[model samples]
Target: MAITHFTSSNSFQGYHITQQFDFCSGFGQFIDEDGNPASFSMAKERAMQQMLRAVPTEANAIIGFRVEHSIGSYVHSDYNNCILTNLITCVLVSGTPVRMEKDMEQKMEKVLLVMDYPPALPIRPYLVTLIPGQNESTLVQLRFFSYTSEPISALQADIVLRTVFGEDIVLPDIGFARIRAQDGEHQTGFFRVNLSDSLFSAQSASVRIKKYVCGSALREGDVHNQRIDMRLEDLFDLKRLYGNDAVAPHVVYEGGWQCLCGAQNPTDEKTCPYCQRGGESRQVAHASLLRQAEELHSACEILACLQAYEAEHKGSLPLTFMEGLEKMASTERMFGNMKKECMKFLHEHLEAEEAAAPADVPDLSEEDQAAMGSDAEIPILTPNPTGDGDTAAPETEEDRFTIKSPFDDPYWK
Candidate 1:
């Protein structure tokens, strides 16, 4: 007879077991006639039949095998399987996360006004108050004396007043800065500064407000090292929008399936491979959904950028969905091309290895070695010298390919 016991740590793919129960009656307890103790084989068969009947007729469910065991006897000398029955369950799960993020990105597609420094500096943490027509037209007060001892020169100090305020105005006084060029050329992308002793030395500086330009500023949340505490409902809401069906309704928190899926789980389960839908084989659909969600998220980012630009520039608008998708397609194509180029390099490397596998070294005689060592004897020029007067020098051919650093030799100096 086939063994009735089964132990699988994880849910097998393609099956679904929603619930299970184990019923064991104590010895000498059951007096009901209909619930009489049956033989082990009969009890096991009946248990199997029960599971078979539980399988959903309308939809698929895991009904692999059901075993009934006799733990102890009930009102009898011998143990009976019917009175001490144990039940096991299994199920299949499926889903993908494609539609959720797309909806979210679209919903939150708003322009964000911000400010940025050229050399990516930490947030100044202090606020600056400025006046347009009064008090030297503009004032910037630092929280404390800067590390640089000398008052930062107008050439070195740059202040970019950003607000997503105006896209067309060529900002004056605030757009010039000492921009160090990588290739020995100077540039002024934006912002020129005028530091004042009153603004710098005073505990605080306040000035009349005037016209200002604006740009995007990184937020506290944008900081790389900051910890994030996100709510599960929000995560699930996002997932649901993106069509993440694999997101389990019942999150197993403490024991199993503990991976975070943008959702907070209070408990966990050892094997959550079963869903209302089915098992592991269906997980591929969910993987594809995740990919879709990522794409949608990126699309949202582009939309946000457009909105930011529009906010800064009046009469502007965000790109159409199709236009954004075209850009995305182009980006994907470029990425694909880059991947192919990388693969080509790997292939070339393998080919080079194969070609070099049987490489041979040419034997050099003593004379050849001596000739290679002494370069002073070798002629720098023959009769056909390009320079002005040079007597015909001995022309001894030597390998000039021997590696040497140009800086290593003092002759160049």
Candidate 2:
């Protein structure tokens, strides 16, 4: 139940609190629409969230709520050389922490907000937060809230329910172990997560949102969502909508199932010949996900570079670029050769960019250095024969590309 669902008497109140409670005041300043704090209710919600923190538990509602808000503008800059104004909203909320009655709070619940940044990624999963849910011997609720326009009926991701003792319970069972959307048409999804006995024995547990292979940020130990604490919102955001279902690898079966490693094997085969993975091995899926993420990331980088080049040239890729790309990509794509080709292309491109880059300025002459103390408006540039403006009076090496022909560079016997 939501705080809004709480009526005057049917208030946001219960006995079992959602998270570990602290006595901190709820107050925050947020940049919101002008004169329209209602346009963004999240400002108020942010203030209330400081009251509760993730622990081995979950709370359904809040009680004894008090909220205050103000919307106003501040002079970011004043007239003279800079005059700018911006609007901001401040929300202050205070609430007595309470949990649902035993009937309602028996099960702990964790809500992960679905999000996408640096858009066009193939897989975007709900957060794997620090305190995802309680690991105690009890059924826990897991929820995904996506402010997506269209319904996502089929979405899947591999999740590892890690215990406090450093044991990971892989969701291998296709039936109940998957972290995926509800079977039918739905905008949001929920699951009653069941963990192993070993996990429950530990004090607390966390959900590990695996993306080390997909993005560089996560690989460098940066927070996946750019924040440690996961934010949960009850309201659906219509203006900011995300309805992409390429969240994970879709299950495909062609007579015999395909391995995550992109290899096609017959049903009788116990292991994949290309990747050497067991037919029922979870490692196959896990490794496949990582490889897919890496490929997607590499593709994005190459695509961005191509797009930038096209934008600068105001048209399609230059003939030479296309020819070079075709030649580089002529290498085998299966296995890991594709990545090597991409790296080779990038290395060559870097050399070309460095050659086109401007040369650095030269140090002042002995006489000019001495003249620095005087009011001498010393010239920094001189025209060379090239007629192009540069810091030097003489031409450096002209940018050149000469590929030695195999037929001419060395005589073949």
Candidate 3:
């Protein structure tokens, strides 16, 4: 049979004066004293007044006050378990002043709500640079990659990253997901920042790199770790410094003479937009390097497919969809293999970034370098393809249990 448990706090029945104590309105009376119950009422008011005086001016009420009166050794047939428990009654109430007790109770409830909700994430230290632009105000794009299984909802993401990195800085609210620059078929999202902000005065007028990971679900007990290596370069247009409405027109060399791309109506003129080298190679060299990296990684798959196509057509490429599908089967196998390999490569790459990152970048102060010897001791970061290092799910808590913070998001810290 399942065992049933009961505590002294539970209700009981019976009558016994094993220990008689009465604190009825407030002048307490023990078995040794025979004080009038009416006289206790005046004492209660006096005690409440003394408590109000101790309360701070701003405090509406003092909470967690409990008074217990017990009459022990009472036995009756109603006491089912032969446990002659004490006849103890506890009267619990807050110590709010008579003048403002009700309003204070309401305020106390509001404080409880705030405590229930998690705190806002602290903005990480970062540098912002304005790439001159006046594009669509809507569709703010923020692209980042993480190795975490627990995905952060759009509601959890902070639209702004504010910090006191160089000077106390606040960045302008720019919309997400607007095209900035294009190279052949490649394009990236534009980031608009204000140049007038004083926070970036001491630092480069350019956006510097600052990396951080998010997700509160990562802190559950006995969790495996997941390293999130986000490639922001893939999402942001690094080369497009000038916007459509740049005050200072871009100047570039064309035919050995410098020219601008967007000046005047170049589209209507069918001429070089601003300045062109006309055959001077419009594509940036860095774009070629990035493309090469992607191509090199996908080379095995692409080559395998191309070879299969040649074999089926006897040296000629397939034109029909059915013929193409047959040739593409070999390529898909190679593609799957390449995808697995690429993830392994990416994991190694992120580990390198983590190792290279400075171990101690102190909060605000620059000179107290001595405080950082231990903090600067860099930990060994190795590639983790499994990503089970820190991605454990959180346990389910009851609805009545109030959590001050959920999901250990670095922002909350």
Candidate 4:
């Protein structure tokens, strides 16, 4: 008799056992060499014991056992027609055997978020009050509003005063405030601004409010940063109070596309130097949404970028920013450009969504509306290289396909 056992990759050991017995008569008890009774049950017990002894002592337990039995009969001429019988049995056991003490060492690793979601809040300089005191300084009041539904436990901002004439003034650090979600619309606080008459007379001035909101319950760590620029004249009735003829300067808020590394790049830049992300209007709009979702930064900036893109693209909005990123990643053009942090943040926060329909409703003339209903080719006008009002016809297929070498050009010659 022969027995074999196969061990799994995780198994500590393998065991095999085989036993054989000979009998002259069928269905009769026989005596062993020690005069003990020999039976199939006894032979099975001996096979099991041998298999158990062969197993390593460090093995936890045995599992997945199989047993096989075979019987043969042969005629012996010397036995005068008596038939001799031989019986063989085999048992096999296979399983993954593991030590309980070593199980902790084989544990799988876990991934964790490096940065927490930023809090949402809007802050601005709301009012200015003249304090009755020996000093001529005025009290500047700032209002804070909760951007999200949750109550804002704490908030702060870095205030910088800049004059329209390009003079930068350093301001005191603003303190924190506890603001309720419902009461945020009416909340206001004061900061003292000491301004000399000469400083006030010089052109218009603006306040740059760099607001920071504490993280919500799901996120923890540093405050979320957002920049807001407001004109001092708009916040207060300076003409009525100060009799200063300073007009408010045209306020151009800093807004642009966000890079993969979360850096804000100018709209004119074609590529981001930090992460090498595309700086086109579509790419910038998508990156801005990612910054808003991940870092809770650039909400207003992102809205501006999206609005500009929509206005430029015939009132058509791109796909949902996250969905657009996914579609772009599926193509070879944008493959591997997305960072792991950005992908992880998107996976944990954003839900699958369909593209939004364009919101703009254009007013078209009767002839234009009729053209839309027909399959007639529309005339597209191209701009001339010169600043003149001459309109050039759209390029034909031949014009587009035709290429000229640099040497053939008049300028090159």
How would you encode candidate 2's per-residue C-alpha lDDT over 1-413 as one tens digit per residue? 33332222324334433353332357767774365536337776676575444211344554555677887777766567686677787887665443455434443233233333212222233333212234542233223322222333323334455444766566531111222233211211223344544543342223323332211123221233321121222111110111122222213466664543334567777664533445655333323332343344353445455555557656434467555655544544444345555544544554454356453233458886786656643122111212111111111343111212111212111
RMSD of each: 32.6, 31.5, 22.5, 28.5
All models: lDDT? Answer: 0.28, 0.38, 0.28, 0.35
User: Which 10 successive residues of model 3 have the least lDDT summed?
Assistant: 108-117
Local accuracy of candidate 1 as per-residue lDDT tens digits, 177-293 = 222111111222222134332222222211111211112221221222211132333333323332222232222334333222222222332222211122121232223333333
Candidate 3 lDDT over residue span 113-193, tens digit each: 000101112111112222222331112223221222232221112223233363333333332222111111101133334
Could you tell me every candidate's TM-score relative to the true structure?
0.14, 0.19, 0.22, 0.23
Candidate no. 4 TM-score: 0.23
Q: How badly does each model clash, as a count of residue pairs?
A: 48, 6, 24, 0
- Which ranking of candidates, highest TM-score first? 4, 3, 2, 1
Judging by lDDT against the true structure, name the best candidate: 2
In candidate 4, where is summed lDDT lowest over 10 consecutive residues?
107-116
Can you write out model 4's per-residue Cα lDDT over 169-274, one digit (the tens) per residue?
5454544342322322322233445655433322322333344443444332234543322233231222122111111211113665543233455767656443
Task: Determine the backbone clash count of candidate 1.
Answer: 48
